[model samples]
Target: MSCEETQEQVSLLIDAELEEPHQVALFRHLEGCCECRLFFDSMLRFSKAAKRDLEEIRLVADDILPLHGPLPVSVRAAGDGANSLPMHPSGLTGRRSHRRASEDAVGALPDRRSGWGWKRWTGLLAGGWRMPAPVAIGLALVLLVAGALVGTRISTIAGGGGPMGRDGRVVKPTVVVVCSLPEVQVLGSASRL
Candidate 1:
């Protein structure tokens, strides 16, 4: 295999995912090419060092903050108050003594929700959005009504005539004749385009 091909297979080899035939070909190339052999050895060293460092880090992390198992009954029942423990994104809820009350916004709010009505309203919309179901339905209803109103035909007098009485009375026209309209042209729906 060429150098690039050998390098590409190096990861698969490290993971034990390379086929025997390909692994043999790669190993043969590594033995003949001093450059490729050095590259392969360096990669192997890097992998070993990375694993060791990660294990050390994991041990230190466990000692500093062992975020495992179920919460204590008292902390679980404490709710989201200032006195309650704050949870990390990884679900590591700290002890109450580790908490700082001033940093807790919920703890700052008064018992009455009415005091922060505007804030409460906006808070409902803050997270990854999904319009509230009621709001979505109301919007759909408004669009339907608007479409109906816009689609409704505007009424004009029949036979392009004035509102002459069917009883043959020469009465004043309640609706004006469009044919007798002045210089203006009335195109109705055709004008929309």
Candidate 2:
């Protein structure tokens, strides 16, 4: 291959990615081209220096390096930073601890021990302490309305034109009119009054 192409493939060749035949051809090209040789030497020197620099840098226990391997989940749990342990959106803790707090806030639900059965609670209640207060009050109000209607009907009948008997009881007009019908007589000529 050309000198430019040989230099371009040199880094890949050092990493052992190219086939054996291609590697031999590129190596022969590199030997003859001084410019390609200088470029390859500079790349090797830079890689060695980068490796040495990385090895010399000290990494803290909680520091998360971009290129390094991931820390274990348990190891993160023991560290101080968020990288060490799973944290909540609030930056305090995870969902498990939050769920526990909410559970504690709302107490446990009433169960069978409270004697509130599904069937009894769902049915229509007639009369009892367990009955809804609104329903009982509504029934009493209906009874009161009915009594008022009956009393009004009775008072209307008493106030209408009625006959008074000797005992001071008011008799119905229909009964008095029917009783006086037989007592009336038609006379042809009577003395002038």
Give the alpha carbon lDDT tens digit for every residue of 1-193 in model 1: 6788898898789888999989889988888988888888998999999988975665455335633347686654443342334456676544422123223323443334345454555445333234555554554565555445434422332334333456754333232223321112223322211
lDDT of 2 by residue, 1-193 (tens): 8777897799787676878888888889888889999988999999899876764442221133321235676644434332233454443443234344344236422342335564354333333334455654565565556556556545756787344667777554321111121122222221211
Q: Candidate 1 — which pairs collide?
A: none
Worst 10 residues of 2 by lDDT: 174-183
Each model's TM-score, in the order given? 0.36, 0.32
- CA error at residue 135 for candidate 2, angstroms: 78
TM-score between candidate 2 and the true structure: 0.32
- Candidate 2 at residue 71, lDDT? 65
Candidate 2 clashes between residue pairs 3 or more apart in a chain or in different chains: 76-84
- Give the alpha-carbon lDDT of every model: 0.55, 0.53
